[model samples]
Target: MRNPSLAPAPGDAVGALPSHWPRAVAWALVAATLVHAVVFIATVANPLVISDAWYFVDVFLRKYVDGQLTLGDFFAKRSAMDHALPFHKLLLLLNYRLFGVDLSVDAWIGFAFAVATLWLFRVALKRATPARDFADWPVQLAWVAMCAVYVSLNTSEIFEWPLLTLAFVALFCCFALYLAAWRALEGARAWPIVVAVFAVTLVSDGGGVIAVIAAALATGLYGLRTGETKPALRAIGAMVLACIAVKLVSWALAPPMQSIPMAGGPHAAAVSLPRLALAMTVPLSSGVLYPMQAQQVFHSFGHAVDMALRLGFIVAHAVFWWQAWRRRPTAAWFLAVATMLLFYGLCAGVLIGRVPQYGEAAFLQPRYIVFYQLHVVALLLMAVCWYVERRPSLDPANTKRVGGAMIAACLGLVLLQAPLDRQAWIRAPYQQAYVQRLAVQMEALADKPEVAPDKCMPQITVCRMPEPVRVRVVVFLRDHHLNVYSPAFRQRHGFEAD
Candidate 1:
């Protein structure tokens, strides 16, 4: 079978049609982006009002207000995400200083980070594409459209999550680091920038350190064939050493953590492989373990349509990997390959840490998918780039059909995601209404009642709320010097019957 890369992209006019195809495609991407925004607005809750959000923000502010926060505390304190992400910590500080515990302002701050995170991925994918075909309008359209679909899959869950932000920050920094390496190869001055981004990634999340290792591996592998291995090796050692230094310091400064009984045997890796694969594809089904396992034909058609988009992505990258190795593996190819390896490393780390931590429920939550989904998306984008670079010899006509099919498949998925995103099975379980209601109740509680407070004066618990959201809600109340009717933690200032 002829490789799609060696053929025409469907509807490729060879510039014969005066850009009939490219304009329409570009408009399609624009429409996708708009629709993505609409879906996000309609379905997602207010950013500042979410599980664990107000609680984390309140903890930081409470410490700061009581003069308990120090520079040392900034590095040492673990937030809801369970690590010291200076990026997130710094954002919290900014929100407090500028907004004075205002939720509206804080929400926008979190949203800004979300936008930056997604944009960085878009930029990284575009950079990974070969420069020759990258200029083609068709490729640009394809690029934006695919990215929009992925981002809109769930608006990054559209809430203020400290850990998620940490992950996104690290992912962005990793992409930034990769771009810096790419520029350095092009004879641009980028090492200083690389060093800065590397440090940022390390502190941002545990994943950041892995990303540093991944970027270095990509550059180092490219060096092996190019015979410029010395510089890459030097950079790799410096970054790894730095990453280790920061993490150790963080560990020393932070409180000691209890060790969990690890379930890391050979079976751990075996168990993780399929979970991660299913997790990676969860976004396609708008965040389900298996959206395509539909029973009814009415719903099955949409599943088929959406799964085709994801399958096309998988097939494209698989072919690109097969073909790229047969030819010269460029720096971008190295990046793509290393990123896939990074995903495996991420999966291994997760299963080892989580399985023992949560036991049977470790792999149940689709939320775990967020940590490595970008790696899958990155591979898909890079695969297309690799294909374009390899088959520059082919005319547009020969290349457009396959390319068009992939792009068409992507555009079709965009339409399907809008409805699925709102209707996701996880949506009902993960809704932010309970947290939102709690936010309002807290505001009203700030003022004392003329009469005595009721027994359930601060009944923060909502029966409808799930455990994850309920726990965070209780934390927020306790942190703000309010009474929580729990045996374990009835606050000091709060009035509770002894």
Candidate 2:
């Protein structure tokens, strides 16, 4: 049975495509992907094991390898975040067992998932556009533009980093689960996929909570439309139960967290205002910050123009969401609404989890940019849907004007954003610095169990790791022949092998 949502919209150009058009889209995607890879290699292709990768190897992998942490503990063990990292731990162990701690393997695995996320976004965009006009230049260009920004270097912290790959894992799973639930809402046999994704979501990071809620809401909305409430109710009930279960298990196993009062005081408004402002602006600020971060062409714009651009995007999205909501519910509407939910939900999570410690800066971190990037892409799709729906009826001259303006905006954004993204990868600031420090520490620790007795080795303060812990991990690496101490790693990095 065909889904009502899949039926061609009025004046949709679905069947008007030329035979070669599909190939054009495919080639365009291919080109975008190649550029993504090239930018990754050019910027962040460092193979050195560093930071959280070492932390995981020390805490989780080392314990597991030494028979201290069993498989059961692996599933329940909490990381420094005080949240279960079963999936992340399992992946780290699997990589260790299969290939013996290769950062490239970890990075490439993350890169693959990043590509998969882009592909899923493409699928969603194709479905979400009301006109489904693949033959139209604007629609095709939108896909290409989305592909470019989806892999933007601003998100390298997740896509290019090995230990931090959990972000992409959660991201890809969220996208997959949402799409599968959408299919089920449309009356497809996607329940199994939904179930599988939900199971994975339990072990993932906080983003999984948003994924399940958004999906359940989407399903519940379907029930409202069809007047069939039982299945949706059951699905929502199951999700609630699963969420409770995960939280209970985490609270039981994880250490007690120090509570910070984020509200309910005379100064509450002052404390909360910055966080709220940062959260609201994250969707647009990422692109604005990236160009400025590049320290090249966009550096001239300074703080005032940057703030203006950020606020402008926020207001534009507000109008777009309102317009999307006023329209009848469709797949695109559901996607836009759900994505909006995700955007704010993630921002809320950041507020609660990070704002106390990091302040408003937490919202601006590169790691958080990946989530907002998806929001931006969804908004772009929504904009395309709005324009394409009206294009069929607009005067030719007016259509040309609007189309030309959109094209200019798209190209301008790409041109402004891409260089900074590329520059970030090229700079590869933290990765290069952290690895160099690790190498120096590893070398110093060589021929001894630790660094010189009187000397304190320089530390990467960003990691908040203690010197003793670093010394112990380095000793373990030497003894176990892992990471910098491993012969393979030594050979790869041009260090003399013992």
Candidate 3:
């Protein structure tokens, strides 16, 4: 296979065809962008508001009311003490300050990030594989479309809050590095661009490790093409500096990680390899449907069947990995696959004890694998596009057919999962309504003279008591076997009753 760097520019127009193909692609991308933005905003804003939005809103409100904000506020007590990275927290804080602590505002903020992510993906794909054949465009577009739609609809806490932003920044930085490498391959001094890209990738997320590796791989490939290693070494140095800087900055801030109490100890052996593989595969087959209780399709088959399904997922990923590597041995493609494998291994270790079990352990919780899924899918898409672009004899019509099939399959899965997502969202209100109603009831009792205001109210006043509050209060107190004026209520300002 010819190096993509050696291929003629897309604008060369060597083939006898209409001159407007490139322009047409540009227009299609624009339309896709608008449609994607609408879907993103609608999904995030309506009945399906993710629970993380509530947590973030609460954190923002607490800080806004208190006149202070810190990374420690985002995690539970134990997690805060462990001092997790604050990059995402900082972004969320900035958004909260500018837009207020409302779900609608946050949804828009998330939507903007989602759009930027798709844009970066398009730009990266264009630079990474600038195909001249009009047939290759559909494959490239299909990859972008799948990523955009799946990511947006599956919008979990990690994707919506911070990781989505991180993914965009990482992709943008990766493209910048790709451009720099491209320049160097063309005999230009582009070290400055390389350094800038390195810095940006580092500050984005720890996962930028993948970007760094890709850069190193690119440098090596370029060196092989030109028989010089200095450029590769320089790229490596930049990546090292970026990683060091991120670590140093994180250590300096060192926000508390002990805020959130963890359910299990730090034992990594609990994560099984087979389980992890199954968890990872569930997303590809079911999109984000596993999170919805009404849509879970794999639970009742017993442990042995679960293990078999997990093995199947591992086999699928293995095939994907082989196909990508065989299609093209580019540094970016290799790095993407390796990083994904490493990430899968780590996640599996945390759940099922080995790299292969990532699927079973991951299940369908959006929070656990949102970023991971995106990276894997993106890399797979990149590999496919690169392969389609390089094959000289491949028919444009055939490429589109295959690309269309992949896109249709992905969209079909997403559509099938939509109803379950909606049901889950509708159920959310009921899940929390009881607690909200109880709080209202407690407020009423605190205002009643018979309940002893001092004993029930404590320091906080239950101002503006609503009618029928006592009725709710009596029902809850009797049902729960609790005193109307429990001492614990007074101790915690009646808020504890709820």
Candidate 4:
């Protein structure tokens, strides 16, 4: 209950906010979630990227920019993944200059980025909430609960791979850009910010294409609905032209996939619509059941329960989004859902088209889960906003009932996840083992100066992690001055790929 004695007078700073409902319960949930995430990240030990950092520092910026190796030679030879990443390159270069390759520092940087993104998400939710719902603490707590679950599910990709910051940055960029376009429809002057963010996003990753395409689609539709046809048309045209330009430049910088040995093989199957549908329905609290990217997972009653809970979450979430959309029926709501769904729905296609094997195992990958979780969270926020707009409340009984239920549900989901969180941390040993095995050979090579610069550490294998890191690590150490291979010597052999 709001304190009658201390209630803010109308027109006062505090009084400007929804004054009828007490905000203590909602803020508590948000604060607790933030604290939990921070503490967990702080305790993480020796987290390493599956592959990018090693090669990025040792190859892309170091050799490619020095003019010692041609784009085709260095790219075809040293590139870990097929995509050309200006952002990744810049990150590697900046890190090299700022602090060198310190794993502890790098891990924290990623954690900070995630924390920042989470806060940005919180702000977004605040902006989306209708004025009538501003005092609806129950819905606010529910949003916090959903966000906690979203952060918990994608630890593998989010915490481990610093390079994935590109995706994180792009996701936020797209959402904000979509909103800017929406404002343009409403005659707000926010397109410059949209254009700037979008331009940087173009170089982040191939995944960024999902954001741009989705944003464009959402903006174009907004024009039709709002009768801002001319403004929308010009915005769409500018966005499309920018996207094309970025693609052309990125392609020019990117190595040809045909240059890789795998591309010569038989073509893989394209992802189907049904698979995309299944991806969309994954339960919000069902993350523990997924096991993310852990090489070895401990299964128990909780896992089984998680499976069932996810099924329930799927059904509940679908209905929730529909009800929210039905309530609001606004272009903003439509665009938010549409943009996110496009990103989520395209996961299968992007993976299948890039690496058929990845597409086959798309459901199991933690990296993909990040995008999937975003779509679900976006839906929830949009729904809650509309639901509140139509049904804001201030009664003590209403607060007790709605807030109690929402808080219980959110807290219940977190308690159920304790076992999985334990499992996620214990696997740090496996990463240690993986890193140790490779580190030993690296040390050996560093000690033996006589080994051929190109031939040293010829075949590297890391078993404790997933399958992508082998080619990644090998290419990284190939041209570096390890094993006492001098800079001149390493530079001379920059054309070789491990």
> Could you say which candidate leads in lDDT?
2
Residues 254-329 of candidate 1 have per-residue lDDT tens digits of 6533221111222333345566566555443332213432322237475675576467656755765565455344
Ranking by TM-score: 2, 4, 1, 3
Please identify model 3 stretches exceeding 4 Å from their true place.
Answer: 1-5, 9-13, 18-83, 92-96, 128-131, 134-137, 155-205, 208-228, 253-364, 395-498
State the lDDT of candidate 4 residue by residue for 190-263, as single tens digits: 55634744544554445556666666676665554445568667766766777677666556765654322332
TM match of model 3 to true structure:
0.59
State the local distance difference test value for candidate 2. 0.62
Off by over 4 Å in 4: 1-32, 35-39, 42-50, 54-58, 64-81, 103-106, 130-132, 153-157, 193-200, 220-234, 252-310, 313-321, 329-335, 392-407, 414-417, 448-498
Q: 381, model 2: CA deviation in Å? A: 2.0
Quote the positional error of residue 333 for candidate 1 in Å.
3.5
Q: Is candidate 2 or candidate 3 better by TM-score?
A: 2
The clash tally of candidate 3 reads 48
Please report the TM-score between candidate 4 and the true structure: 0.71
User: Each prediction's TM-score against the native?
Assistant: 0.69, 0.82, 0.59, 0.71
RMSD of each: 8.6, 4.9, 10.1, 8.3
